[model samples]
Target chain A: MRFTSAQRLDDGVLEREFTLGEIPGTLWTPESAAPVPLILMAHNNGLPKADPRLVARARYIAARGYAVATIDAAGCGDRPPSAAAEQARADLRRAMRAGEPLDEIFESLVGPLVEGAVPEWRTTLDALLELPGIGGPVGYSGGWTALGIRLAVVEPRIAAAGFFAGGYVPRAQREEARQVTVPLLFLLQWDDEGNPRQRALDLFDAFGSKEKTLHANLGGHTGTPSFELEDGCRFLDRHLK
Target chain B: MRFTSAQRLDDGVLEREFTLGEIPGTLWTPESAAPVPLILMAHNNGLPKADPRLVARARYIAARGYAVATIDAAGCGDRPPSAAAEQARADLRRAMRAGEPLDEIFESLVGPLVEGAVPEWRTTLDALLELPGIGGPVGYSGGWTALGIRLAVVEPRIAAAGFFAGGYVPRAQREEARQVTVPLLFLLQWDDEGNPRQRALDLFDAFGSKEKTLHANLGGHTGTPSFELEDGCRFLDRHLK
Candidate 1:
């Protein structure tokens, strides 16, 4: 791990950019010197780690006294693009334009992305935990929902998870949801234009966790109510802090 | 309207038992001498206003500086029973015992009950608001959910509502849900044994509120997490206070 740059923000949060091997990422920590639990924020597909929404979420949760980190996915942000992923993206666009069924297209696009991103995230998690001022029990939050699900199922360090359910979830991943047992807070936008509502509800049902909660609000893909930020913080506090 | 009994509880909540015409009810108010917003809690079918759960919720919300009130439905609590309602209950039991289709039986049971209860609730609302220390902008919370939908659609005074989606929602009431425009906090027990989870999700979808939220927790009908009480209070405070 190598630190690329660091800046102190007006809100007293320390924002640092780093590179783990080839994976670029950012970390945000509060002013508190005491080690705090960490949150690994997973961005929506195509959203870079530096996207404003992810940055705002990172800052807000860090302000609540937790260290927050997010890393660029396999072919996103400052990283080299994958030829296969670009081909899948073009296929998705063509399928959508032709009003064709998109199950295979989505599977081709998101399946490998998740397959590659999950290990990168776990590896990043490995390095992030080794850093000073960031401590365990970690929480996995936000989209892609599939990544969160995979991590919640396989990552023993993730004590809790909060997922945004507006992203494409591959069919095999939906089946994998039955293996997740950690406490979960799943948020769904009832009117999210880009996501199928039934698929989201079905995924919420498939979670095998004994303490899963789904907070569905009326809104488009980006219209999740702002109050959820604090709510997610409280959930993390209950489980992590 | 007549006050049948009044007692000041140890927690500084003023508990009052009252009757409006043939309807019996209870109200809980904080120690505040000034007026406070009111929450008209609708009890689950057959659970009466004085049910322990209802009392606990009322007192809890009352302590939050809001006056909370609940009243007996047409054939619940100290009120006289209707022979017709008795027949419907018997039919419901027989259908359940035989694994017969229950749509008509549930409709017969809940549809008229809501019809009769909505007007009684409105009349009680009139009398309660007229009383000192109980102010405008009432919130309707809890079940029978059909009654809440009816009251929310027909009563203009209710500013917000929090619904428990464990009760059987008559098909007609599901249709009426689209007309309820107030901000809503809908709670669903994802594994509620007595309630169909898909129906609850569908009803939540049909609600027309521009600002509706569904909070689905993993539990049976009676297992809503305790933090939801405070969550609901904050929701009401957002619109009612």
Candidate 2:
């Protein structure tokens, strides 16, 4: 991992960018040199790693003595979205619009990307945890629900996680959620259009975590209530810090 | 798995259409009272389970004392092609015309379907293998190569397998091919349009099968040479039965 530069963006948030092979990502941490809990953050499909939503969350988390790391998912940020990725998205959208079962489309685009991303996340985690002033348990906080669930499910290194309601969980990967045993906080947007209420609830029900929480709010997918994030942070603080 | 009916289709070839829940599939066995090696077959994108190419292959294999079976890939054949599958095809065609990488589009549609199909294949295999005369050391011979590679990698039950060159292998899933160790025969069309020559050779090189053979012929993806099929049959006869 080669970190290119570090700049204090906010009063307490220090933004640093780095690379691991072709993967480019940014990290935000408190300016202080004290050891702190680390949270890996991700945004929704329409946003980049530095999307305002994730940046705000990273800032909030970092301000309270936590280190947050995020990397652009393949073709998401600072990288040209491959024509292949674009084509996959178009197919997914067309299929969804046509009312066909979107499981195959979702996985076709996601499975390999997830396969590629999982190792990257683990590698990033390994490199970041080695940095000075970062220590102890780690957690994941992200808006793209399945990426968070999928990551948490496959990589047991995460202590606790909070995933905002977004994408669908393909039937093929649904059983993977049962493999997740860490503390989980699911932020469900009751009126999320991209994901149905039942789907979110069903996924939440499938989690193997004995210590899991679902924070349902009236907003749509993009409108995650602030208090819920706080509650999620408190959950992370309890488990990670 | 329930066997609804078995009908003698063409002299030596007997067709049995069965269902497992909503899944529809077919089996072709030689009209005989003896046990034989079985080959589970899958056709490429241009064909269905009963596509002339696959049906012909099944008939030839069955005539040679091999029971061949195939099912509608989820959202294919008897079932309506999901919008996702259709969209993926369209995207692939457009990308091929535009000289863009088709792997993501292929994977986006195929990956999830493959994931869903794997367990179904296992279930179908379990059910078929239990029937009176159809016995052990099952083999998989299929087009749309990744599904076969993915299956052969994960499911050790397959005794010996052959996969026709079809789709591109993503880097993430490429390593999984290294897990395949059964006696393998890859039938390659030298001038395949959907699958380029180098990709086929590369994937063949990645296979962990120490007993693997690559039978290459001069033709496009659509025009498979006849002599190569006979050679492939001999290969299957040597290892499968």
Candidate 3:
């Protein structure tokens, strides 16, 4: 991994843009002398690493004394788009406009995205932990929650996860959720128009972790309450610190 | 209201046993010069104010600078038993043992209990708020959640509530939940043996509070994680302080 640009925000959080192979990424570190626990923050629903909400959350978490990082997922911003993913997106749009069932459409769109993204994340984790100011026993945050579930199951370095639960989770990932034993803090918008509430509740119930918590608040898809940000940090603090 | 006894605990909390007319009660207050916001802590179901878990929670919240109070429901603790309530309890036990439906039995048992308790609680609040070091804008905590719903609806002094959602809520109370507009922090134990999971989720959905939050953890009825105690204080702290 090579950092291409660096700047310090007003709050003393150091933000740096970087690249690993062809994947673009960003990292935020608190102004601390000692190395801090790393949080691998994936953007919601394959959103870019630079999405405003994701950046805000990254900086907020960094100011709270954790090193946060995010990378552009496969077919996301600043990355070459896949033809098949484009076709799947078009198909999804057509299906929605036609008022068709979404199970297969969602699976096709999200399945490859999760599969492609998890490995890049693991690679980034490998590089981030090797850096001087980033350390072990990481926590995973943000969504696409399918990727979070897969990473939590496969990545032994991730000690806990905080998942945003409004994305379309594939059937395979829902099944994999049963294998994830890491402590989880899952946030769901109670009235998310884009996501069915029962599906989110069922996925939460499927999680195999003995220490999973679901914090559901009243809101639409993008309307998670701000206090949950502090709660997320506290959740990681219990596990990582 | 008449104070029967008072003592200072090891942590500097003042525990006072009191009685209002025929009802027995307890109040815990933090060591502070100024008035603190009150939390009317109802014991789970109709358990007495002196129940061990109730005392522990009351002292914990009191030490955090809130005055917490609880009272015995109509037929609980040291109060005289009502023959009707005893018959309902017997019917409930017989229904559970015989694998029979319990809707009517539960309504008979809890409906009168809630009706009787809510008024007593409101009277206690009236008396407690009149005393020095106990101020207005109260928050309600604990269960016999049916009683909580009724109180949150009828008692305008209540600003927020944290309901422990493991008790058998009467069907009438589930309907009353929609009228409760106070901000709520509802806690559900995911694996609570005695409470149906779907019922708890449905009740949470039915709440009309725009600022409501549901915190579900992996445990049975009495196994809410210790960290939730701190979280509960923070919830009340946000609204009350």
State TM-scores per candidate: 0.95, 0.49, 0.97
Model 1: per-residue Cα lDDT over A122-169, one tens digit each = 998999999888878899888788888888888899999999973469
The residue-by-residue lDDT of candidate 1 on B157-229, one tens digit each, is 9889999974478887888889999999999898887778888888888888999999989989889899899
Error of 1 at A195 (Å): 1.6
Better of 1 and 3 by lDDT: 3
Q: What is the DockQ ranking, best to worst?
A: 3, 1, 2
- The predicted structure with the larger DockQ, 2 or 3, is 3
Clashing residue pairs in candidate 2 are A108-B107, A108-B108, A109-B108
Candidate 3: tens digits of C-alpha lDDT, residues A1-241: 9999999999999999999999899999999988899999987554677899999999999999999999998787889877888888888878878878888989988888888888999999999999998876799998678889999999998999999974468988999899999999999999886678999999999999999999999989888888899999999999998
- Candidate 2 per-residue lDDT over residues B1-241, each given as its tens digit: 7889888866668888899877788888887777888888877643568788888888888888888898888778888778877888789789989999887887786677777778888888888889877986788888867778777877777888888874475554566888889988777665577787667767776777766655544456777656446656767877876
Cα RMSD to the true fold for all candidates: 1.8, 22.4, 1.5
Q: List candidate 1 segments past 4 Å from native.
A: none
Chain A TM-score across all models, in listed order? 0.96, 0.92, 0.96
Candidate 3 runs further than 4 Å off: none
Residue lDDT tens for model 3, B1-241:
9999999999999999999998899999999998999999887655777788889989999999999999988878889887888788888889988978878889889888888888899899999999898876799999668889999999999999999974479888898899999999999899887678899989998999999999999989888999899899999999999
